[model samples]
Target: MSMIEFKLNGKPVAFDGNPLKRLLDVIRDDFGITGTKEGCGEGECGACSVLKDGKLVTSCIIPVGAVGGCEIITIEGLRDTPQGKCLVESFAEGGAVQCGFCIPGMVMAAEALLMNNPHPTEADIRLAISGNICRCTGYDLIVESILLASKKGEGLW
Candidate 1:
């Protein structure tokens, strides 16, 4: 066991356990943050997506040790932010919240994209969320939602 320190949701935190433990497990079990869900533990699915140092990554594929000194932002951390609110409100207003299993990952992916490209094209939005899989919604609404957020949430991202 090792003590790994990192910034989680804008706060500095530490974990003392198996270094090889997945960040998803640490976030959900150790830190009790259940917003980030595990879909395909193999990392093929983006349901466990989180922001690692402001980049979108699958928490399930990342080891706890790898995140030391990095900033990790999960859905719980984002849902309250202005940008997050914009994305979420866009998702809701655009009817992209079907089934809602992959919304968190989708939102995270959108945030990661918007932070870098406040004015992204459809192709950009598609590519940004390509890692995520949403069985419901067909991605049209999600794409439109992101586009809407980009336009409506100007100066926020």
Candidate 2:
């Protein structure tokens, strides 16, 4: 066992456990950040997505040790930020959320995209969130939501 150190939601944290432990489990069970859900154990589903050093990744398949010295941002951490507020509000206003199970991951994907590319085209938005699968609104609403957020939440990204 080793003490894996990383920044979580802008805060430094250490996890002393098996290095192979899933980051998703650590975030949810150890760190108590349940906003990052687990739709599938595999990485195909984006429900367990989080921002690792500004890149979107599937936490469920990521080893906690892999994030050592990196910054991991979960939905809970982003919820209070301006970017998060913008995306959430945009998703809501654009009817992006339905069952809400995948909304958190979708928002994380959007955040990652917006932070990297503030003015993303529809194709860019679609590519950014390609890993995420939403059974609720298909994907038009979500795409529209991201586009709207890019316009409405300008300068925040």
Candidate 3:
């Protein structure tokens, strides 16, 4: 077992558990952050994505020890941010959200993309969300949402 300390949302927290325990399990079971979904145990799916020090990563594949002293931002934390609100609105307005299982990870990935490339092309948007798969929208609406969001200034987010 190992002791891991990190910022969850904006608050500091610590846990003692197996070093290899998935961050998803620690968040969902120990920390009670259910917004970060577990679609796949492996890292291929983005359903378990979260921001680790402001970069998108599959929480399921991240061992608890790996997150020691890191700041972890889950979907629950995103909902409280201005960027998150903008993305959520754009997602709903553009019909990008469906079934809702993949929306959080999609939104997180989109936010990361927008942060890096404020004016991304359609192909860039596609590539940004490539790690995330949606069984519901076929990606057209999702792409549209990212494009629409890019026009907004980073300060707005």
Candidate 1 backbone collisions, by pair: none
Pick the winner on TM-score between candidates 1 and 2.
Answer: 1
- Highest lDDT scorer: 1
lDDT of 3 at 54: 88
Candidate 1 regions with alpha-carbon error over 4 angstroms: none
Off by more than 4 A, model 3: none
TM-score, every prediction: 0.98, 0.97, 0.95
* TM-score between model 3 and native: 0.95
For model 1 the local lDDT of residue 133 reads 95
lDDT per residue (tens digit) for residues 1-157 in model 1: 9999999999999999999999999999999999899999988779999999999999998999999999999999999999998899999999999888899999999999999999999999999999999998889999999999999999997
In candidate 3, clashing pairs total: 0
lDDT, candidates in the order shown: 0.95, 0.94, 0.88
Best by TM-score: 1
lDDT of 2 by residue, 78-98 (tens): 989999999999999999998
- RMSD in angstroms, candidate 3? 1.2
Each prediction's Cα RMSD?
Answer: 0.7, 0.8, 1.2
Better of 1 and 2 by lDDT: 1
> CA lDDT of 36 in candidate 2?
94
